[model samples]
Target chain A: MAQARQEDNATDAPPEALRAEGIVKRFGALTALSGVDLHLRKGEVLGLIGDNGAGKSTLIKTITGFHRPDEGQMYVDGEPVSLRSVAQARALGIETVFQDLALISELSVYHNMFLNSELTLKPFPLLDNRKMKERTKQYIDDMGVNIPSIDTQVGRLSGGQRQAIAVARSVYSNAKILLLDEPLAAMGAKEGAMILDLVQKLKNEGQVSIILIAHNYSHVFEVCDRVNLLQHGRISYDKPTSESSVEELTELVVAEYRKARTTS
Target chain B: MAKQAVGGDVGASESARSSPGLGSRVAELLLRQREASIFFVAIALAVYFQSSNSAFLSSGNIRSLSEFTYATAIISGGLVMLLICGEIDLSVGQAYGFAPIAMYLADQTLVLPVAVIVGLLATAVIGLINGVATVYLRVPSFIATLGMFFFLGGVNVILTDGFPKTAPSGSFLTEILGGADWSGIAWCLLIVLLMHILLNRTRWGLHTFATGGNPVGASEAGVKTAKIKVGNFMLCSALGGFAGVLDALRIGSIDPLAGGPNIMFFAVSAAVIGGTALAGGTGTIIGAFLGTVVLSIMQNGFSLQGVSAYTFNVILGIAILTAMTLNVYVGSLRRSGRV
Candidate 1:
């Protein structure tokens, strides 16, 4: 795996997996994202931090093709493309793990993993359950996602497990650019650590570029290679994680909060 | 990773150590499957009825029971699928009433095959209307199909002038459809088998589950939930109409008032009793067939015992309520993995 990653890096691969320039999204009279610029480098984890209503979700949706940006340019693997739907974005190897995880609770773990992209028996429309179950088990083992059984309903799993399954699904789908929207929200310490470890594992694999939208600064500092802060509908701060601290990030956000109080 | 390994090890050891008793294992199996419990109940009912009345298991009575079971089984086969996908067609019975009349009118001018096709198409149109109103126009299926129920019921009466029409007879197609004593049951079994495979083995079935379980999540996963639901509605109505035509051929007549709201109630009741959730996302076509069997047996058994017709309705009402209550409890157990 290490040799393959090295060979990939040595090849003429794009430096950046995804890049957005001057992205603007408007909802009626309100501008959710205005002149937003962001980039995720190849095989890098980029932490995106923002206050509530800071257009983090809007920006992520626009990138995922869930929402059309009124004005912007997006490049995947250094090639300019226009995405009109989530399906289009997925076709381009861009997958989003939404905050809700987008899993049918009533479905089994393997079924949830292969949702909308099911494997079928050749010459028949029947689901190839045996193949899917085997693949699902392998993927879960690869990601170190601990679940009692692949046949267990997704609703029976914990929040952290569900989150890991969602991430694993995106990874297994051959996602080149993954955007995780608040993956650790509402999770306990153990659960949050599990997701953090998964992210760290993905970072170590060095296969996919990830943009993790998070509120926790320490988590961002832990797994992210670089950090970007969204404020006033644009990236206001960008720095390598090595040069940044949780205190520095907190102070910047707090200062903005103080400024907002004074103005309002 | 180490923690996960330890957890797995602990789980394995715990299961190895327990080696649950046979009685507990059987309990676990039954508790885990709503279908199994219902199956045992149906068997027990059969045994009790056979012991009480010698005529209960006779060929003649069994044939009558099958006649009752076929309609419910076929109708609930489609209704259960629709319910699993979070939709319902309360007007299925109306479609059932409408199809035979449509087929009879078409037979006057067209060939038998063409007439049958026209009948099925007429019901498919009803389904399409229900699908469009519920999915595209954003009307709740309950209200939309309820309107269809009254409208189609009125149309059936107006078309037949509130009189029963004599059914066409002596054709091989008609004989195979439902004219033979065992033909209706055969068709019902075939439909149930096909529906069961469609639900368990097909992508469309999985998509239906996903759509009903979580529409937003299903859509996010790229499943066209609207299309799945609309397709289910169409299937439900078509099945209802097919069951109606079968009944018409068997009885050799078509009644404008036959298979009205009562048939819809019985079909939905059978589906629910068979373990199909009204809340959606979970169901079994085989279970629905068994549910129809249980209901038909009960109705047949009671009449064989010389029970009053009025008392049969009261008993059916209680049975439905009891089955539904049990279903909810069983569903909770399944979700919690207690079984």
Candidate 2:
């Protein structure tokens, strides 16, 4: 029945842009992700909140095709899709901005922006550096990304600026579904505002879907349309941001913590 | 990427005005690093040696020094590529000798040209073995290539019974590969120029830098790091093979122990002194070329001045140590944001 729904393409649109059902990932004897189901409709931001070792990162890795699930079903636009590599996920218009930012420290901003997807003329694999640099400058300006120059190495920048670059890179990849793993950490006031605005713009366009992993409830409350609380490798709470309050999310986490403490 | 950035010209005029200053500052920073230091050391050594023996600056001595650096420079090109890709092939030294020995063994049956091809094929096979052992077998390149080094060297010795082969003298293959004149130097220059372009201007080269800088990052970015490394291993072995053949042609004979680990050590030192980081992610082909020149100059100058072998080794060792220490220091400066 799940396979049939995924294959149904007669309708004009699918219910969800990206979805995963029963994702289970194991590393040796330990299960990183056990039966985690996630949902994000088109043009929606789903905030993923979790405590330490709550398997948020593992879920992201599985979805991004970094760590293939040991057992699971992943669907794109209601079509069953198997993601075997990051490149495959990218081809499906699913781009991820990892917390590490995935930027080469030695490379310049422009180089990092086009790290895997470089511009090159046909018949020869030489880089079009001029075009790449120009395009990167254009992107930074449009996004108001606080960068000194396109030529500056990403490592030389402050942590906030590096985060800005990662967001810009994902946004530039033209992703239909973007995953940001703690993108706001170390982000400065101005840069954070710019990234927030960028996400808002993409959300409003009704063309992109987003899944953000954020620790702060306030940030999640601001822009995320819905929130899912991942507890112990499972979704313990899921609701629209309007239906949920910070006090309620905090109470839920605190209860879980107390329960775990008492049980242990 | 996303329909191209719409408003890209906001600060174009302003940054254009500062472009000249920024460009120069970047260049100044680059020169402040390891490359310039080694260049100056090479020049200073030249001046000092020339002052001692007027013949040190003679055209004959200069030509000889240039020729001496040819094989080392060619092999150093591949070594630098491998090193930058986060692996090293110590077997290039033995692979070098193996190429010529393969040719020599083949020459006993086949024609000279056929023998050269066989020799080159032999090196490629050795390269594949080294690459497979490292990439597939999960052996670290240092240990894998080191094992190949001894294994190949022993094979050359055992097969030849420790006797040198008379290099084929009159064939067209001999004329070209042996460098009837300074052709080996030309080959070295061509290889350096090609590799320089490959390392800086091409996508493959960018992938190389990415792989060396952060293997995990590069892999995540869709770069097949394993394939890149394996390709580099093959390229290094091929270049080693070419250099081995060229050296045999020039020397008029193939010494059973011609391109030993000691010689590979000198080539590696040239790369390190030239700013190719032993730790990877940083290096320049031109720097490697100049480093080979400096090493050759030291050897030539010291020998001309009647320095004993023991003293020459000691002095050369000290010089290399000092140069490499400087390289490490400058590299740290880059990490600290000085570059």
Tell me, by DockQ, which candidate is best. Answer: 1
Residue B231 alpha-carbon offset, candidate 2, angstroms: 1.1
The residue-by-residue lDDT of candidate 2 on B1-339, one tens digit each, is: 443443455467558655668767766655565567668778899999999999998888887997889899888888998899889999898878989889989999999899999998999888888989998999999999999999988998987889998888786768878657877898889999999989888877888888898888777767788888888899889889989999988888887887879768878988987888877777788888888989898889989989988988898788778877777776677678755
TM-scores for chain B, in order?
0.94, 0.88
Winner by lDDT = 1
For model 1, how does the per-residue alpha-carbon lDDT over B273-337 read when each residue is reduced to its tens digit?
Answer: 88888999998898888989998999899988999889989998998899888878877887776
| lDDT by residue (tens digit), candidate 1, A1-264 | 534644575586638899999999999999999899998888889999999999999998899998988998999999998899999999999999999899999899999999999999989889999999999999999998788899999999999999999999999999999999999999999999999999989988889999999999988998997899999899999987878899998999999989989999
In candidate 2, list every pair of residues with a backbone clash. B178-B249
Q: Model 1 misses residue B91 by how many Å?
A: 0.3
Model 2 lDDT per residue over A1-264, tens place:
423533463254557999899999999999988899988888788899999899998999899888899998999988999899888899999988887777888788999899888998668778899999999999988776679999988878887778778878877888889999887877777767767777777777667899989988988998988899998888889987878999999999999889989999
